[model samples]
Target: MKLTLKIWRQNGPEEKGEMVDYQVSDISEDMSFLEMIDVLNEGIIDGSIDDKGNYGPVAFDHDCREGICGMCSMYINGEAHGPGRGVTTCQLHMREFNDGETIYIEPWRSKAFPIVKDLVTDRSSFDRIMQAGGYVSVNTSGNTQDGNAIPIPKENADWAFDAATCIGCGACVASCKNSSAMLFVSAKVTQLSLLPQGDVERNRRVKNMVKQMDEEGFGNCTNTGACEVECPKGISLKNIARMNQEYLKASFTTE
Candidate 1:
């Protein structure tokens, strides 16, 4: 198989980026996207790119290419993590593409997620959001309540678990026209606030998390489902609505 890659390249966070094209031959369809890039990088390492060293080996953020870590993020062929559904970029194999195809690879584009290099962006914004109070403040030593007797409403428990599946990959922001992080924030807020432990600090948690989300400079969500479609976890936009309700209610009820 042969394909052309138009990959975005940037020197640093402040540097302007552009797409550069390269063609490779005899690519195996079974090769993962990263593996194909590895092959391309090998060719690049074999030499320099003109006098500017432009065509050097490519760089992209990747940790655990197996898709469990959600670090392998890329916008391939105008889609988040390529055409695969409900899967991370690392799990995307080349089989999804056709021979003699031209693939456009770009990084997650958002002001909050500024580019660090060729294809890697600073995703620490998510960590900071979590730090701003995404978790339960209650610190349990040991021997809490009996799990079975908690009597957690089945609907609440299920919804919370679904929301917890979010892996914090920035695909939601990347694919959203407004680059909003509402879905991600909603997932965290919904997951925590739905439970009894999380209810104690519900008002506080929602306030801090929403504040952190806004501070990160992500845009607002107008109910576009693009984030849900691109999310590797298929996190629903319903959570965003839930978060909105929670935040508004907290604003009125909390001291």
Candidate 2:
């Protein structure tokens, strides 16, 4: 199949960017979206598709194309990870588009996640948010509690597991009108807050992480629910509710 791709191109963080169009043919419907891009890059590198005098290959992030890493984040056709439910860009297939369709691709847009190049944004803001307090500080120096020793309710365990599935893909932010990271932060908070291992620092954890999230320039969530809808892992909006409750409780209890 032949297709037209209008992709964003930027040289560096401070450089101006714009949409550049290219044509690709003989694409397999079975190929993943990234694989299709690979074909385009190949054409560009070989000067076969060089209409704009060879701007080099498009720069997009990808690792573990199986969708486990969430690194293949792309805003395609105005939707995060393209037009799909519960799937990352790497998992998106070429068949989702018509044979002669024109696809528009861009990177995640947020102040906190500034673009490093074409289609590649610096998401280290997420890493910083996680570092603020997304883990348990339990002493495991031979005094580790046995996994079976903790009598956790199955309901809580399931909810925590669901929350833990968040891959930090930033779709939650990209889809939000405000570019909020609330859904991502809430999922991180819920995963730990529901578990016994994370009980020790619950109040402080919420306080620190939320503070850091704000410091990172992420916008506040106004319950528009876009984050929950676009999340590749389907992380629920309920986690945001839980996070709010935790934050309020932490404000009162945490010094």
Among these predicted structures, which one has the highest lDDT?
2
Off by over 4 Å in 1: 48-55, 146-149
lDDT of each: 0.88, 0.93
The sequence of per-residue lDDT tens digits that candidate 2 reaches over residues 1-255 is 899999999989998999999999999999999999999999998888864734599999999999889798899999999998899999999999999999999999999999999999999999999899998987879989897798999999999999999999999999999999999999999999899999778898899899999999999899999888889999999999999999999998867
Q: For candidate 2, which ten residues in a row score worst on lDDT?
A: 46-55
The RMSD of every model to the true structure, in order and in angstroms, is 1.9, 0.9
Query: Per-residue lDDT tens digits of candidate 1, residues 164-250?
Result: 999898899999999999999999999999999888888898899889889999998878799999898989999988988999999
Separately for all candidates shown, the number of backbone clashes (residues 3 or more apart, or on different chains) is 0, 0
Instruction: Specify the poorest-scoring 10-residue window by lDDT in model 1.
Output: 46-55
Model 1, residue 165: what's the lDDT?
92
